[model samples]
Target: MAQIAFILLCHKDPEAIISQARQLTAAGDYMAIHFDARANPADFQRIQDALNDNPNVTFAKKRIKCGWGEWSLVQASLNAVEAALDAFPRATHFYMLSGDCMAIKSAEYAHALLDGEDVDYIESFDFFESDWIKTGFKEERLIYRHYLNERKHKKLFYASFRLQERLGLKRDIPSDIQVMIGSQWWCLRRRTVEWVMDFCRERKDVMRFFRSTWIPDETFFQTIVRHVVPDTEICTSTLTFLMFTDYGMPVTFYNDHYDLLLSQDFLFARKISPEATELKQRLGELYAAKGIEFQISNEGRSLFRFLTSRGRNGVRFAPRFWEAESSLGRERELLIVVAKKWHVAKRLASKIQEVTNIQAIEYLFDEASCPMPDLGGIQTQMGKRARHRRALMRMLYEYYDTDRMVICMDPKNMEMFQDFFTDRSITRLLEVESVFTDDYLAGHAIRVGLAGENTPSQSMERLLPTIRADVLGESDRIRDAGFERYYRISELRDAQDNAFALSQFLTIPQDEALQIAQTNHLFDD
Candidate 1:
């Protein structure tokens, strides 16, 4: 078996990272870490002390300050790769990952695949997915480019013609330009790592792209691989359990879509949290009972795994009352938006009252004095805020099941309530869709006549001018030319369909027009 070196780029999360190291050790993989520059010596020593007990663990001498869009991150990754090469000369494959990431696959499975794929595995990185409009050239912002299916990278670059002048960066096509991506956290053969390092040193513009782009993490390697490598595999996506919710919070516990999480086809999971210790233990016990040994690296030693489909029968987990049907006739159609504080909640409540004309009965619970449920009864703590939230959600579902009685909040807080709801059926609860940031809403508005007819045309018309402005204003040192091509060439075909036409641009669909007119009391023109 080829030895594997798993490297974690750790920051202030020393405890979490250290735990991960221990987990890695259990899985029979070697571990290494590069602490962020901001990490305290004491914190670093704490992690060091823990890992010092293990002969296999290697801690780096220097720290890296990874800039989001700069070469710092790429350099840091390279540093780890170099260290792994030197420390574990016998290790044939090196897997790079972040402190926030977790492995979902058993070590045997991952190592087996890496051993077979004598080549490098980096995940795909398209230009549009990179944060171009949000952080590229200041004045050139192409927001619609992402949605356009057929646009080419060249078209986008030409669109942002002004980028060259602003950044003084020139794009010249060399005879050799490679592209490849697999897992962002990938298993690289020794030669592939060395080849990558040499290629980066030789490519000046590539380095410049890494230095100037908003997020060069994926793009740098992807662009280079496509240019040089013969056969590379796009490995895994980065979205994992942590991206599903605002986890790692200090006070409250959140329930995530655990079933969905286990369903991912990927072998490794990113951003596994330490806070889910209880859940992890349960998973481990379940797996052990089934005679399947779940393993983790040193940092992730305490992680748990169970048979994916048996959650319902194996455990008597309580579903959130709001997420469940009300036993009493009073099921409140309340929307609770979670926020940082009560004032923000109050302000949001006022906005909902104004827009939907629904008044929410506000209540407060302090965390310090909150009563947690005991075996037979809930021990009454008088003032915990989370309890108040639980009590309020329960009341809404129990006492107020009416048309006007609805709850609304930002998507952030809705995630927190994920623990309370298990029945995903639409008929069970009122789901107040957010008008903000939901493109589906915009699409539905046109389909249902709530938005003006010719909305699609108007949306494109509104969109095209912005595209022109962004193109004429930015730098060309973007992730790739793919985004430019995708937006410019591809969208024209989509624009031809009537069904695809936005409501603001043309006459609405008859079925939808009627629904909109009826809902808003607008007469047919």
Candidate 2:
């Protein structure tokens, strides 16, 4: 029988963890939970009380006070793995999951996927050769030793690191074992798990070295598995799904994003904030129902491959020397150009660029290509357009090397703006009345091969009413919400407030912008 022992390392939100544990073990799969010693004792007791009755759940006895970028986290995980082996002797597989992660699939699905495979399923690659680390000391993580926890003692730790760099200090990564790095999420066969424990007991020298290395939990099991297991039995991917920003911060999931996450291929998702009550409860309910089968498709897996690959800006964007004040979006200003017609959106973007200090993109979501700043260009995959557009939006907000950007998107595909409401300081919405014009017709002419005034193909005709509704209804709501970026071409043209509209983001003065728009008939559609 293929049984899985889900090892969850939990710290906070006892209620959320309790829900997750019960839901995951509802079908007789085992769970070994490790609560961080730093978490509230009452909360831990509450979890124990809730789960004490279940024969399927066991708590790790060796509670470590886990801190970020420290050896304690790995120690905590090791303790949980030991507890799982002791309690669920029949469990043939072990899964390592974060405290905040939710199991999106039934326990039976995991057993099915790993039915007969003797594999160590984790991501592992050469540290020096790989460009996966966006903002971190790559080879320096291994070549140097660190004592101070980077998160806990930021200033002292960096000072120590700098002192070492000045001294040309180098530490030997234990003999002949290739330096490897990867995500901490992993699942392993019982035999491989046992082998890892045995190695930990025998290899005290290597273990000592890792204790002094920064964030070794990320590499400890991943690196050890590559050396211990045969290449044929190793898969460089994880069962869990999580995405990070360019500054190496994991994106937290909220209520709105749960649906998007479930559509992906991963078995589990992480960084579900304790504040996300709705998202947590909904996932619990969905998984708890009987006969629910969440299938992992080839298409979702393909998308995952593309995202994790080097082509997604690699570490090429983040130089090891430059430090981040914050993630890119927080400091940057964004103006969204929303119009139903592509040509109209493009013209507005051009006008905005000419007057303002924003790097304006012609078409964000179009049939042909959306030229990304650094990423040569992107071909819009209309099939999975929603997820595709969101992913691109996230990337641009995090990594696009500019303080400002103007994205031109049609109302039908107005994807990026709302998703990043919190990430940006200046989020502007520019809605055009979307009056049909000969220029719009001329652009469509190339596509539909229509004669004069062909009233936009049947699909566009059907979509127009919905677009009009959204545009007409959203203006008052946006204005009431105190969003100054709420710009409309009709308002600017009718009231001659083009200068006032351009004032906030102006590279040129308001009078000059007004004159330019008037001279070029820029506001006339």
Candidate 3:
């Protein structure tokens, strides 16, 4: 049977770790615990007892304290991996997951996933940006000082090492190699695991390099494997949710976003936060009602699927909503744009005005609120923000209310303002209605071409030119204002309007578009 090995670096969160172990064990996956060296023996004993008699559970080596900029953490994780491989020699694929990562896919599906692919699961790490290299340190004192100054004391003990600053070693640092970030957790085939272990065991220089590096957990296995197997299939993104709240921090899954993990694909979700127990229970109910399950495929591969749900089939777009207007019916209007101080929203607004002949007002919220908490004084904050939103939303509707055709760049603050406006007439802006991500306005447009409802007979391709023009026009002004470069707005616009265009932009197919849109909530549910 294919198996997932849940590994945990123990700390203050014993309850969290044990709970996760229980969940994974219940789901018929293997569990392994590597208690941090600093943890009291009593605590480890408690963990052992909690995980007792679980056929899949294994207590691995005691872990040494590891610092952020050091390699000890990597060594500890590698130890757990070694133990898991030895204990479950029969498991075809070895899954390395964290105690924090709940299992969301069924055991059968996870097994199937392991059985399906022929390649090693992790991605190439050598292409990461060079900036990540600066994080590694070798000296205990310098490492301590850096962490102390950075207020990251929790990671101090394990990382600080005497060999970090060896000058000869510094000369040996590979310039061609780049550091990449990944889940401290991942899965791999048995052969790949054995290969990685053997490679590390034989390379003395590689062992030396691991001693002084920062975030060695990220680079150790990933970089080592890249040298031998140049084309492994790394799970650089989530297999489930796009984003999730973990311990109150928002983790997103996007360009190089590997932190937002999923517990499973079909039935369960990782606990968003320890505080969200109620929410998690509610989520479980939601999953049960949906009839998702894991089973062996006809090909005898373990795979998870949903019986109640089928994928969607269209281009889905998410738009940012406008902020709420305090002066919904106010007569006098203001059109102040708000954004980061350096964002240059004012210049963009000016260019839009130049093209459309509409006057724009600009405000720097950062400057307005400066000396902010530092200056204890009058409280006009709420009033100031409300004033800006009310003024801008009011002006946005002015042309619409009067039946005038016009376009204006929202003050950067209004970047999220599209969803809040209530007027149905305001929905005519094809861009806003189709692409908003805010909760204020009517939810995302579901302009499916139902036979009876208003549907476009012209394929999404036919409408692409107009959409491209509008987006390109807007982005040009934004770029002229000194914003960073991206794909030409024309390219992005077509990707946004037509599903087929999006498939081209992403280089995926039409069927994939529906899957992406549904999974990402890019279209209305």
TM-score of each: 0.45, 0.59, 0.49
TM-score-superior candidate, 1 or 2? 2
Q: Which segments of candidate 1 are over 4 A away from where they belong?
A: 116-119, 125-175, 178-183, 201-205, 232-259, 280-525
Worst 10 residues of 2 by lDDT: 318-327
Error of 3 at 238 (Å): 5.2
lDDT of 2 by residue, 1-525 (tens): 688899999898888788888887886688999999998999999999999999999999889999888889899999999999999999988999877898766555656778856677899988778886767687777777888888889999999989999999988888968767888999999999998899899999889988888888888888888878888999899988887654557867888655455655677888787788888888776654556554332233232333344233212333222122223355666677666566656776776667554678766565446655553233335444434454455466556557677887655432234444544356777666545444544444334322123222442343345434444444444445454557665523543565566554344576766754454544444
lDDT of 3 by residue, 361-411 (tens): 344233454222211222247454443543434444453453322222333
The Cα RMSD of model 2 versus the native structure comes to: 13.5
- Cα deviation in Å at residue 406, candidate 2? 26
Candidate 3 least-lDDT 10 residues: 299-308
Per-candidate clashes, comma-separated: 96, 0, 34
Q: Among all windows of ten consecutive residues in candidate 1, which has the lowest summed lDDT?
A: 483-492
Q: After best superposition, candidate 3 residue 145: deviation in angstroms?
A: 14
**Relative to the true structure, how large is the alpha-carbon lDDT of every model?**
0.46, 0.70, 0.45
